[model samples]
Target chain A: MRMPSPKQTLAKAEMDMTPMIDMTFQLIAFFMVLLNFAETEQDARIKLPSSELAKPPEVALESPLVLQLTKDDKVIFGGELLPISGLGQPLSREKRFLELNGVDPKEATIVIRADGDAKTGVVQEVMQLCQENDFEIFALRAKQELAEEEP
Target chain B: MKLRNTGELSDKVDIQMTPMIDIVFLLLIFFIFNFRIVVQEGDFNIRMPVAGPSAASIDTQLPIRVRLTSDDEGNLTGIVAGDRKLDNFSDLHQFILAQVGNDAGPDGADNMEVELDCDYGLKYRYVISAVTAISGYVTADGHIVKLIQKIKLSPPKKPS
Candidate 1:
């Protein structure tokens, strides 16, 4: 009698990629949620002077001392006119008042908002007085669109 | 058991994956779709002066600032200190130095701080000149010198 024919072998294999695909999608979602574009737009119009040691200001929006300089050389503080000279005395007094009321002076920052047409002389004068008053942290206001213009 | 199964084989087997090919492709797609590339430029059309960092951090109490502007003929104009009108660089520098020298805080801190707000249309050379003059006000003895920080270059705004 002829020997039984060799049995044909059957091969069966399958891969389940559901776990890997799920992990990939999760990673994609993480990056999408954390990106920020508003920071680039916040100071577009303000042209900050370049310095090797210059750094971004550390002040927040609520407690900063806001100073605005107009093209006509008018100095506005929190929407009020500030005398061009001897501003340090009054500002220091204000700081003292804040401290008395429980605000920390070191946590306070001065914000400078100036027009492009403002003169260099005026800017220098303001800077000098701020230095005298001992205000350490400062923020320069600019439009966000302007920052994007740099290469 | 009718006829014994002579040729039957197992019907299921598991295969291991290549492990990282598809993950990389998905990552590449995610970045390409979500990335934001931007080039920033200021709306103010002014050139700014350069300066080194001050030796000391300014005091937080006194918030003195100077505002600079130019007339149609490019003549500098603005308030220097103490509400006085300033037309030239010499007066500006002297006023700054004096203000800083005499600054006395409640805690007896003599720290000084300054901000420069310059007009956008002004020339770069003029801005530099002003910065140079201001630097001289920082006394060499270190007793009268304070920090000059925050130079703002922007366009003039209309009064409200």
Candidate 2:
């Protein structure tokens, strides 16, 4: 038996990275396809109130009860203006209504999506209502980049 | 027999990429499922305040949340403590302090927790004023008060 020279040995020791590159490209494509853009746009009109102690919510869960506050202090939920002077009673009533309809109130977190120019009174009114409704988990929606400057 | 040596070589090489492709696909799926893309929108322009490192964790013993709202003129308008509405910030802060001072906890310090809910579009100065007022109430009498420690600032909720 004759042994191959150093040049032949070097040629046989080459590693082919084509498979690895292909796999990487495939993964990138998969992530790009599964991204959800609709949820990203839903809160586009919500300008969250800032705070020194505010932190981005730990986890993003589905089925959040979103409350949109307009500049005129009109509260819109599910594309309809809620007809209540204050947020407390109406929200409690709505949560009860959801529970009556077989929805779990505890599983639903409240997302306060307020217009930047909306009055603070309106926001508080809603928050006060949410508290009465037993909604403890609250998430204030804001741009991710802007959230970094919150604290 | 006449044999000649040639230096020609093919550029293509066959390599098994099934396992590598499978791993890449798995990673791509993981990120795709975990990636959260958030796009925020709202009418209010808010500049949130920052604080130096203070005590960690929320004081949940006497959690009394206060919400402040400003009118179109940027003046403090409404105040809410828990589910009750107060006339103004002064009243709200005084009420909170009174409650905290009365409660007897460990070390004789009040264990009241205060959470502030402010409007997004309200002037930062107004929020600061409210916060200052609340802080003052917590540290009154110069007796080394330590009841209320954590101050949580939250966004105001829209009325439903």
Candidate 3:
């Protein structure tokens, strides 16, 4: 049986959007927890060297220490310039503190982000310091793309 | 067929969009603040050849040493593998594979360890190319396998 259309139904159209809005909020929350801002700690002034053989480490360090080497021969640690020769004292202190806090110094990783033009010797000094402090793992940061070489 | 508006109803209830738009804007701002732009800086896990003078040394086997030398301008001048001067990255990869052999070790260990001694001045591009070449190989079945699983970095020699 064909019945007459209701006047209220023809006057307005309304749709529920609560489900979609809930999904959007969930996505936002997911990214907020996953994004690790500390990982992008490269100094803008330092141009990283590139390597084709360089692959991302299998496991990432939770609290890997960062050190930067500039072309001017300055070793920047935590934004303060430190002498290449004097890096040992602080490094040892860091290791000692890590030990006190129950973190094994041997398990801790140190990442070195150095400029290509920086003297190899200066970079080695930092590596040597890390080695002397009983730290085993070290990561040398390099850009993966060959086309992105800094002019 | 022409129809008449016989069932018209009041449509005066306007939905408020101001609060919904404000919430969306707030969510967008939150994402922008928390998002970290990852600079694809490949972390080449180059462990030191010698784990300092602390741990007792293991006499497993001698690693194939590939020395990379650079000029004062940080230009990669030479790539040498025990007296063989390789011109390109492919040669470096081939040379290392030739030395390691096609068959895996009896213990299923790739056993082919390479220690790279790279110049600090040498751009990372060269190092990575050489590393990429020597580390993995394409099998006859078209499968890729890493030839040299273990890689160690030799400390840079001081520039004279």
Candidate 4:
């Protein structure tokens, strides 16, 4: 008689990937919702002062130009760092660029993001320079501070 | 009827999950690296044209003069609003509130303008605080009661 064939006891182990896929898609969705693409130019060197009344505007500003002021009295415009006095060239360039696009320099809003420790005089000088450049509309940026709840 | 039986199971199609999982993990890593926690920012608008004599004369009501002085280290030393000397920002806020009542209209006192005269060495944060105090205040109902809608900065004084 033929030898008894050895018993075949192989089992296929297939893990259920449905739950993992579901979780991964959910994670992707969560991240997608939280992703901000506003292109807000922020600098790590400047610490903005906080204010309770500083509420984000209801409507977005028209033609905003951001000027970041470092505590050391330097201005960061379009990624180029320059002293307050050196800002004239860049300001004129920006004004010309705006005019080329048919946008009045006065119509553009200059968003000033100055360091909390920066000199108030320097901040004023920056504003004056912008004013001289005919960029009149100014917005001094401040971080939002939440008030404590009253019992 | 006689039938021939072929031993077989159901046909199963195995999808390749390796490439898909690889792509998904890459996307997740991309998003993770791009994630940044940014603080919320707001603005205190100041419309200052080139300071001309005519512009100052145009306004019938005199702007409230706010003077902020500081020491050599840029620490606030004193706050003077008009003729009154204020101890802190809260006093300045109250002074403004008293001057400009909580009214919003074309003829309301909210049209009052504040002219900030900051010392050369004053810390910029104090200027922001002064602006916040004069601009508006948040009420208990979470509504922002705007006081003075106009603000201007005095020409920078000589460094002391």
Candidate 5:
């Protein structure tokens, strides 16, 4: 048998790190693109009702006003919690703001995020209040219900 | 010490990669920690002008009324579509499908509207289910065929 070469024994073991670094960079890029920094106006207190027909709108809503209705019938708008009765003043303010900005309150979308457990009456009341403020368009927000797996 | 010639340079310049790899790993970890798998949310749009029935277009016909009633605990008790009583949402969907059919033109569903008349004490989930039934149904292949695009609410009844 031939003896092993001394040069081969003396050489340091090296790993080709190019492939690993390339893969790591690819993963980082993938995450960077998918990262969502936009803060959606969602409140944890309201557990939205789920519906199979509620697909996301193809066209983005223009200047939507998000209102979260808690189970207890309180409305959360612009980070302030108020009773359904007290929503009129804030709604008026909102209408005025829209007028000042030259946007029609009728064109503005009021997105209602009502709790699944909330009373239907309260949701209607909120809608009525929005109508009083001349906010004609309303979007009832619902969680997307995942389809059940077939056997 | 013996001095090497200044004119002679090494064939390969070893660039240190440890710090770069460390920083890259930190970034990956940060993103992984902050990564959130958010459930998708959707909306049901309804145009209800301040002016009650007068807001409706003159050409459009009367809206079909679907009533939802509930018990004291807010549980859904009954569902009525116009004059017919529906046992459940599926029944309501069938009723709507029979009425609307496939007569929708290229512009989508007809100009028909569905008015939701829900009881004050009813849970919102039932109302959503009713809306889901009235709006549309997803085919087996996951395609959504819209039924009625125009939906409005009837005047809310007082909670008993």
Candidate 6:
């Protein structure tokens, strides 16, 4: 019998790649779902501020209250154009979310997503309303770095 | 002795997938890294002042209310701290230090709260400046010492 060379012996007929490819596709899919490109409460009209001093929360805020304001001074909550005077009504509902989780409303956080050009007064009014509702924590949504300043 | 070549072996072909797998992994890493960049746009953290409408008496000293006013053309004209009008943010910081006193510990203003009141028509640049002034800035030694740790937004002044 003639001896086959080492090169010919080393060549395998097949290798299974199904598992790795499967896991890779799963990872890609998970990232795609987590992207949430369209379904955020952040309205394009609302230009956020930037802060280098801003730091990420040590604890994650679960289901935070979102208050969106536009440069035109139109405050929108729950898809309704909430008047400045009626800012309290939305919080009455937001507080219920904390209550459901058995967390005190005072301990919950409220995020103020305001436009860059939005009047300071409107932003303050929203905060005041959150205060009246007993929500103690407030997060002013802003770009943490200068890199995030791109439109 | 003569060896006969195997036809089946010569005809069989196997595709090499090492390069393809390597490329896919690179793509996977790219997406994973890009994920953090995308998530950064939406959320930021800040604290609220505890002195609300109902709790005025709870804390005797309220936060220093800093009202940011603008000109008719939407330019930042003045930074009003209580009844006194400050020339700029530097003055604002000096005023805060004067009011709170630089104890370098948990001895000033209790919670060291500040209320930032901005205008609706003004750009966010002015508001950001105020926030930075109130929250403190990076010193020459790269240390971040805050004038006030707790910050709140003042209610909007209703259109007269």
Highest-scoring model, DockQ: 4
Root-mean-square deviation per candidate: 13.0, 12.4, 8.3, 3.0, 4.6, 7.8
lDDT tens digits, residue span B1-160, model 6: 8889654556557678888889888878877875733435434345555454445324535667888877766689888998899999879878877877754446565555677776655566677667777766565555567666566665556656
TM-score-sorted candidate list, best first: 4, 5, 3, 6, 2, 1
- By how many angstroms RMSD does model 3 differ from the true structure? 8.3
Provide chain B's TM-score, model 6: 0.63
Q: Which portions of model 3 miss their true places by more than 4 Å?
A: A1-38, A50-55, A79-83, A143-151, B1-20, B26-42, B49-57, B102-110, B137-144
Each candidate structure's TM-score, on Cα atoms with residue i matched to residue i, is 0.33, 0.41, 0.69, 0.91, 0.83, 0.64
Model 2 lDDT tens row, A1-151: 9888978667456676777686678768766776665564364445544332233445565447778877677777767676446556667776888789877665566776766456656665666566657664555543322212222
Which run of 10 residues does model 4 chain A get worst, by summed lDDT?
A2-11
Comparing 2 and 5 on DockQ, the stronger one: 5
The digit string of per-residue lDDT tens for model 1 on B84-112 reads 77777667777766665576653222344
Model 2 error, position B109 (Å): 11
DockQ of candidate 4? 0.79
| Model 3: per-residue Cα lDDT over B45-145, one tens digit each | 55563354323224335677888888877778889997799997778988876776744566222555677888867755466567667776445554456
The residue pairs that clash in candidate 5, if any, are: none
Runs in model 4 lying further than 4 Å from the true structure: A1-7, B1-10, B53-57, B102-106
Please give the C-alpha DockQ score of model 5: 0.63
lDDT measured at residue A95 in model 6 versus the true structure, 0 to 100:
84
Find the number of clashing residue pairs for candidate 3: 6
Candidate 3 vs candidate 4: which has greater lDDT? 4
Model 5 chain B: ten consecutive residues of lowest lDDT: B101-110
Tens digits of per-residue lDDT, candidate 4, A1-151, equal 8765554455577998889888887887777777787745888888999999888888899799999999999999999899888999899999999999999998899999999999989988998899889998999999999976778
Q: How many backbone clashes does candidate 4 have?
A: 0
